[model samples]
Target chain A: MAALRRRVLEVLPDLDPAQVTDGSSLKELGANSVDRADVVTMTMDDLGISVPVREFHDVRDIGSLARLLRGHLG
Target chain B: MTTRSGVAPDGVVVTGLGVVCPTGADVDGFAAALRAGVSGIGLRPATVDGEAPGMRPRLVADLRGFDLPGRLAGLPQLPETTRRAAARVAGRSPLAIQAGVAAAVESWLAAGLHRAELPGERVGIVVAGHNLTGALAERARAGYQASPAHLPGRFALWYLDTDHVGSISQILGITGEGYTVGGASASGNVAIINAARLVAGGELDACLVVGALTALSAMEAQAFHNLGAMAGAAGADGPQQRCRPFDTRREGFVPGEAAGCLVLESAGSAARRGAEPLARVAGYAARLAGTSLPEPDLRGEVGVMTEALRRAELIPAEVDYVNAHGTGSPLGDDVEAAALRAVFGPDRPGPWINSTKALIGHCLCAAGVVEAIAAVVQMRGGFVHANPNLDESIAPDLRLVGRRAEPAEVRVAVSNGFGFGGFNTSVVLTSTTGRGRPSAARR
Candidate 1:
């Protein structure tokens, strides 16, 4: 989850890293649709996980996206 | 500053200038480099990630250390919201857009738009940009390949040519008309000419003309290399001597990046707003060659210059200086020299000609406007910077400026720009003192 939040900060440089906590909703952290999509795709690619891009729309927070990546790995 | 007599009371005049090039970051800096005859052309770094260690790119004139946010920081009067928005987008936008925004902001501030007093609905914007395939597009394509299921929402808007004008207009709050002009290398002149005509023809009070190109892709460099249109690739002295325009040893132009902006306002509007005029957009003409040749035919080139001079109501002999579109290619320089000889006559004392491209490699779409700025700088500074590498003259009849800067009283100046597909544009500019303004603001 911490790594996921870090990747989210990389995609959205305008946002503050400290405010992008695991429990922070992506939208609340100033992640627009494009920013959200880039964060999910880049993180997934880094982790070598294959998930349908449409499924990223359902991701609400950094923790949930991390959990989804863990589920795919298992 | 002696005023030339032919300027109409209703002429279109340049109120301000903004520029970003390898030579300098702003207008004054660019002019100083021009006056000193400095060459910004140098070897470019490899764009590919894993290239051979010893590989060096062909000649390139790039803005090595330009940072948009840092530039914006120097202009603090702009609304914080506007500045932040611009910086945010520029951080993620294409390089060309970032360059355009920076240039436009400089021009805007110079024109006093930061004062927030101009009517937003009456001002227009026209930016010239060519070559759509570059690093941004290459990266986007690769990103799509890596993840076909997801594409960035702003992907399409990023590359579209209109977005250049759109981004500048949105930042500055110009609500009038916005569009882009492109005709390969001639695009810069085409855009400036059209914008001037629109203001002169009474369609708009003022127009912002900008030319920006940051697409220095290795692929494009390779394409030019494959065509044997690049200097220093085969038999050449070295990269430093690659772009010697009008010289006998000239091979081809070095690829360069630059963005230049000029604010064209009607004479009446400028006086009303108390804006100091820099120069007058006296007359302009553009001609499209019927055929698509890699090199231009001198006939079309000759016609464009004559037509522009005729429209300006001036004879060929009245012009004192010429900003020649000398691309440093053997064929291109010869054809352009022949065209000038035909226009100015073979045996008569002709206009003193110089190529800004020698200092800053051919800026493609930005060449025309950048050269126009050079002309204005020369007219105001009372001197002309000679072509640094023009050792052996190819155009004997034409009087080319020499190696060192010379003291010349430039009354009337002409700038010529030609593109790949036979697109040629010629614009006539006269010093602001010669135009409709008072001499109180003379610098």
Candidate 2:
């Protein structure tokens, strides 16, 4: 969880990972379709993990996105 | 026997054209860009310091190299300075004065009507703008931040006090009725409709219709960001990728700056003055959607558009092409497509449809006149321009022209411009020399 938090923070330092709980929504954090694309692209390049774009549609927070990424990595 | 006063005279004709857009500075370049399906979207060199989160829409047909006319060249180059000076002297902002003069000159030259020959007092002007002056707001912000006492009188000078009609009267020496209409993107079309009514009623021999809008300031940009409307960084996919209208993957609209002008004259007056007609203004109509701002009402669009066609005595089949008010927004694109399908029907031979917004970012209030120019050019030149980056098919057999010009016999074309607050307007244009009823009979 710590390693994933660090990784996500490295990509979007403007956002606070502390507030991104498992139940947090990206839309609630001011993230939009454009930001989602950027985050997806950056996550793929940095973590060598591939997640479908639609998976992020319902992701509310960084913790949920991280769990989803872990499942893709496995 | 028909009554004399009750009978409507011949409709007005478009005799001249002038445009300043990101794709080209004049009608020729604008037309060529459209015909060639060139995309004008691009990354703007950072003009200011503030990072707008998300997709930063960069694709826009920007007028980067335009030189002001000799008369306007002496005015302040910065919008803030110009607005202040113009307000002090003419009781209006500088942008209005400059735009008014440019449109008047272009219309006059296009009509081949010498200013000296016509009654200058009878020539009227109507102009539309979305924002007052972003540069002025920027200056005020910087000044207040630096020191409270540094605030200049220039901040208050940004008001466009002269209505559209007043600006035209001052610049072109016109004395007839002049007024500005404010209705979001439909502003330009509404102005043109008003001008046409006045000309058709024999209220004026000629009228100049102009539309102009500038880029958003940091504050305005932030407001758009908050609305979830800005394209964000995904717009970096290249200029052509910035605006995709009617495409299923479409995201949002790109902001752009532009100004356009058309010289309209009554057919009788044009003939008397030996001026060549470019296209005839067959019919004009406007309606409101009663919807919230920024979202389109498909039913309203269909009702007003069909009514305009009916007024012109045109069936859906007679329309050869449509210049769509496709803003590239998700909701807007869907609504517009639905409206087109409803009006023309699912089975009819669909008119070639494309968005001028694809070539130049949404020019806000000026979009109507700018798109009208595209329709006029296609009608006169007999070809429909394609929409770029339209990856998703809108509807089967809809014929949304993409990335190429298609040759067609365009006897009649409909140009639509819908603005915020559900202000909807549609203008119909027909070829002057093509197979149609004589101008006299239509009158």
Candidate 3:
């Protein structure tokens, strides 16, 4: 979970690190559509995880994105 | 009352100038570089493998070490969130847009205009260029190189021409209508003329005319190469000699990229705001040959020049200088010289003529505005910058400026911006000191 949070921050350098949490909204963190795509791509490479891209369409926050990745890894 | 142009005395005038070119970033720097006859032409590294295997490096006039974020730092204060958003959006936006926005901001600042100072609904914008969305093609190419699935679904934003208008409008907080003018390389002048006419006709109070272009993609490079329009790989002679406009050994234009903006305000508005205008948009005219052949049409070029001079209410003999659209092509240079002769007639000494392309390569769409600014600079400085690379004149009848800046009193200057498909534009500019009497009273 910590690694997931770190990866999101890495992709969106403008995001306030203190504001990022499981409950923090990705949109509120200034993760625009392009930024979101970058985060997803980086996360996939870092975690060695495989999840359908469509699944990310509904993911709203770090917490939700983490759960989806965990489910794929499990 | 009517001015000599048959319009109100307080007609369209250019108040501020901004540019981001391979030569320089600011207007003053750009003009100084032009005076020194500095060349920005060089070999640009290829991002993609040569389409023609074993082709040498591409010769281009690129803005070296262009720092966008550093430029944005000079912009007016905005909310932190807004700045963050701009930064994020800029990261994904086209380089041309970024350069255009920078030029726009600088022009606005130079004009002493702020969003809070002017009514957003009254400010107008017109950005001109063809293929303004080259970044989309570049991104798509990068995506393919990375992986097919890496392409973003929202790539459509970068592919649309309107996106440029929308992005600039949003950044500038301009609520008025934004227009995009396309005319191949003549687009810059076309947009400027349109904006000036709009303001002169009372449809708008002021307008920002912007022209922007970025480095070409591999596909575009190949197309120019295929058309035999680009200088072949720099042989032992090197890239500097590749874009020698008007030189006897001239081959073709070296591709270059640039972005620039000019603030056109009605004389009344400028006076009301106590803003001293740089020059007057005295007259402009554009014509299309309605053909796609790469060959130069002397008749079309001649018509546009005569028409522009006629509109400016000046005889060809009174013109002090002409900024030629010499793209270093063998045929284009000769055709342009003949057109000047047909219009100016055979005199002992013709108007001083020179080409900026020899220094900055050919900036295509941005060439018009860039050269327009250069003409104004030369007029103000009391001298004309020579074409440093002109070893031999193709047309001995035309008095092309020599290899050094010469002292001359320029009262009026004309600039030519022509493009493929026979798109031709000519604009007449008069320095503030040499301005003629207005036939009519100010509005």
Candidate 4:
């Protein structure tokens, strides 16, 4: 979760830390499509995990995205 | 407005200049370095990524420490929104793209376009570079090999050379027309000519001619070195001494990296905006040698010089100075000197000549626009910069500036660019003091 949030903030430095709740979406935090993909790829690299492409389509929010990557770890 | 031939009768003027190179980061710093004969060439550090550990140190002039955010902050004149956009947009991009952003911002402000303002639909950008993905692709190779899916998604957009056009256009809000143009080493001049034509043809009121930094990978560097076209293999004394254009001791060119920008506009538009003109793009010509080889062609070189003068409607004797494409290679310098003598002649009292490459090294694809900025600097600053390393003249009768810079009121100057694979180009730039439309006056 922290890694996802960190990557999101990396792309949008102007976003307030309090607004980065897992329930919130990257789009809500002002991350464009390119920024969303960058954050996802960067987070994947940071966690040393590669989630399959189709699985990411199920991710509704930051929390769901983190949960999917964590499933790869477990 | 465009004429029946689709060319404007009005002149095109350079309204702004920017540079990010090893010699300096801005136009003012670059101008001072040229006047003092400062050489930015040095040994590429072995620790740099992708360099072999046991290989000999290669000579290169790198922009040692460029921080894009810091560079933007230094430009107090830039709007806060634009500065933030530059950082947010290109901070995580490759070094070359970041350098282009800095140069673009500097030139945008210098042109006073930000304060005066123009419709976003009327401004365009032309990026001068190709194969700009060498370093980034090489760096990503190992990562992809480890895990192919882990490659950053932004890589798709960033890898293309037109990333310069997209990023700069998005940041500057330019929407008229934009694309990347290539001519190998002559990319800069090609971009300039394209941008100038776009403005002259009335397709746009103004356009930015950006010379994107060429970040060569080790493989590309090794190829040039293996071909015996790069210095530092045998031309030793020091890194600075290796780039000796027009000198007998010159072995080959020393590679340099830089990005530059020029804002070219129609004369009437500039006057309407009360923008100060830097230099006039009086005339230019580009020709092919009909060969796909790497060697310079004497006929192509001489042809462009002659045609450029014909287009400018100025005689050879009227050309006050020449910013030569002397890359310090033995055969290349010999060919260029012969071309100069053929056009301007040995006994005819010709234009003073010097090579910006002697001080800043050869900037590969960016060399043309970088040297174009150098030519404008010398022209407006009232002096021709020194050749720095011309110990023995390749062309003694030519009035090449010696060890130190000299003062002269330069009105008309020729800036040349030649690339491998038969691209040859010459641009005629005239200072504000020069007459307006010599041929038009005759008509």
- Give the winner by DockQ: 3 or 4: 4
Error of 2 at A24 (Å): 72
TM-score of 1: 0.89
lDDT by residue (B1-443, candidate 3, tens digit) is 11212333666888878888888887878888888888888886654653555464378899887777777765555445445545665645667777877787777777766534557766788878767666468757765576655444445676776666777777767776578888887888898898888778766667888887745776677788768787776456767767877778888888787888888888887786777788888788898888997778888889988888788777788788999999999889889988999989988597999998888888887888878878877887888987888888887788888898888878778899888988988998876775443333121
For B333-436, candidate 1 gives per-residue lDDT tens digits of: 99999999989985567889999998889888888888898899899888888799988999877899988888887878889999888898899988766443
Worst 10 residues of 3 chain B by lDDT: B1-10
TM-score of chain B of each: 0.91, 0.86, 0.91, 0.95
Q: Where is model 1 chain B poorest over a 10-residue stretch in terms of lDDT?
A: B1-10
| Each prediction's RMSD to truth | 5.0, 19.2, 4.1, 2.5
Model 3 complex DockQ against the native: 0.33
Candidate 1 residue pairs that clash: none
Instruction: Please tell me which model should have the higher lDDT, number 2 or number 4.
Output: 4
Candidates' lDDT values, in order? 0.80, 0.69, 0.77, 0.87
Q: Candidate 2: where are CA atoms >4 Å away?
A: A1-74, B1-8, B46-59, B69-100, B144-158, B161-168, B437-443
Candidate 1 off by > 4 Å:
A7-18, A21-32, A60-74, B1-9, B45-57, B140-153, B234-236, B346-348, B434-443
How well docked is model 2, in DockQ terms?
0.01
Give the winner by lDDT: 2 or 3.
3
Top candidate on lDDT is 4
Error of 1 at B358 (Å): 0.8
Q: What DockQ results do all the predictions give, each relative to the true complex?
A: 0.34, 0.01, 0.33, 0.84
Question: Residue A68 in candidate 4 has what lDDT?
Answer: 91
